[model samples]
Target: MRHAETVTFGGSGLDRAAALRSMPDLMDRARREGTALSILLWRGKPLVQAGSLDQLVRLPMDHPIIKSGRHVDADSEILLGREADGTLVFAHDMSSWLPAGLEATSLNTFLDASEQQHPDLPQDAVFAELRRIMTSLNARDAELAATAKALYSWHASHGFCACCGVASEIAQAGWQRGCPSCNAQHFPRTDPVVIMLILNGNSVLMGRSPGWPDGMYSLLAGFVEPGETIEAAVRREVMEETQVQVGAVRYLASQPWAFPTSLMIGCEGIATSTEITVDPVEIEDAIWVTREEMAQVFAGQHPDIAPARKGAIAHFLLRNWLADTLD
Candidate 1:
């Protein structure tokens, strides 16, 4: 595999059995015959080992907690994919479960460190924010966690159909929604964003959003608007945000960012102009950093910048850039 394929949340060869989605009896049969294993999610947090938050805590399809979840919401079961062992795997949304003395207000804060335990689950297992445990899980678990979280988030916000403005029903084993009123089908959509590594000689451009934690900066990125290609987006976003003119844009890597589902297309760009004019409305600040300073930042020696967040495509790209491995 190429180095880019090793990015966090990258695929682990999970066979998404798309053909079996039309079989209405498939899920029922799998669950009834105790032939499937399931991972659990509360809100967007995944059930993982509490202390280390490493491995995903998979439960039998017939486990009591999952059975109770099925009773509450029959549509909660989502067919993730089949594992290599030929075992069916599913993700159960247990978001409806409420623990005692819960501070519902602060459930999913910016970086939620809290974990909630389901009474029926083992003491060591708890629901944790995927962001907090993403790097700890193996590639397979990371892919599953990211997939399940993004799917659940889409369902929660898209209960109503866009075409008919009416309630839609989940279909295709949670892969799509169908509107009965207008018969409009909506599939899960991933927003495409272009993150640029604009290099001018020995320096690269970086920026931080308005509310980002202090001293944290990343490659300039923005959603690819309608009628725009990835290269177009790279140039446009860099120009729009920092008044930089980019030339010769090339794709480097791509990452599945599941914080509400975005495909971050990484690109390298040659900066024709280095001057920056910040658009306060778009970002808080923008600046150029030398490769030497970036090396220090990654090593925890930079005085003004926080380390690049691990598991983020920004970090992956920057690390490779420093190591000369962006092949």
Candidate 2:
């Protein structure tokens, strides 16, 4: 955990400016003064300058896209944070718009069409899947993208009051939802998931879900159920997935996985029993991989398996495990 902050979306330390969120007058004034920047999202993908996907494509508050986004009156816009000089940053969801004459397709195709349609926008600007480029983004971009994705996803789904089934209004700069009918309040939620690297001797236990890309496997993971501790969740998940008894579970690092808002709590667990019993319903396959094989997988030289995707906590943990640097 020594380098935990180095993880993608770990710690960018953007000033949230919490006090300003509740102050509608100040927020409006700031927006009117053109001191705010907007991060645009198309169907959950962040807009980035296409080359390398290393930086976010930030549009000024008055930019055409931002203006059109406001005109659409789409989903809730969340205030992400402010930069060091106090310029406000906001997330604007623009999923409602589509290019004329371009048929909508999957998320990937939609992103490409969005960029292609905007000839007046920055030449390199395009909506990019965060997962595909998260590992390459700098700390600040990663944090902003993750935060925006999570907040926007929350508002998109929780539009009604759970208490009274009445439509809820956004409040507190998109950080909260208020139910007018029941006078109840709701906040953004981050689901806790325990992803662990289970070790026994020189090998680690890994599994692949049913629909994962061919030859790809990752550490065992599951949601931390209600009233369950992180350690207990780790043990339970490993046991349930692979029938591998685990002991001495401890935290390693964490990553903000904003695919529908999840917080992946990475941990290292000691395996007490190595007998393999795959849970057919939970995972397609599970196996113990030795340190040597893991190294080859990371190097892209393995004959039968590819390593976990680069941005995920699975790859992070496995990389550290190979280097013996998981503090």
**Best of the candidates, lDDT:** 1
What alpha-carbon RMSD in Å does predicted model 1 have with respect to the real structure? 1.6
Q: lDDT of model 1 at residue 90? A: 90
| Residue pairs in candidate 2 whose N, alpha carbon or C atoms collide under 3 angstroms | 1-327
lDDT (Cα, tens digit) per residue for candidate 2, span 1-327: 899878888888889889888888887788889888888776677888886677898888778756665433464578898999888998887766665654654455312333332555688887777777787789998999999889888988999999999999999998999999989999999999999999999999989987678899999999999999999999888888878899898899999999889999999999999998998999999989999999999989999887887878899999999999997
> How much lDDT does each candidate structure score?
0.87, 0.85
Residues 40-130 of candidate 1 have per-residue lDDT tens digits of 8888888998898999988897787667554235687789988877678898887777778786546656578878887678999998988
Clashes of 2: 1
Residue 111, model 1: lDDT of 77
RMSD of 2: 2.3
Residue 190 lDDT, candidate 1, scale 0-100? 92
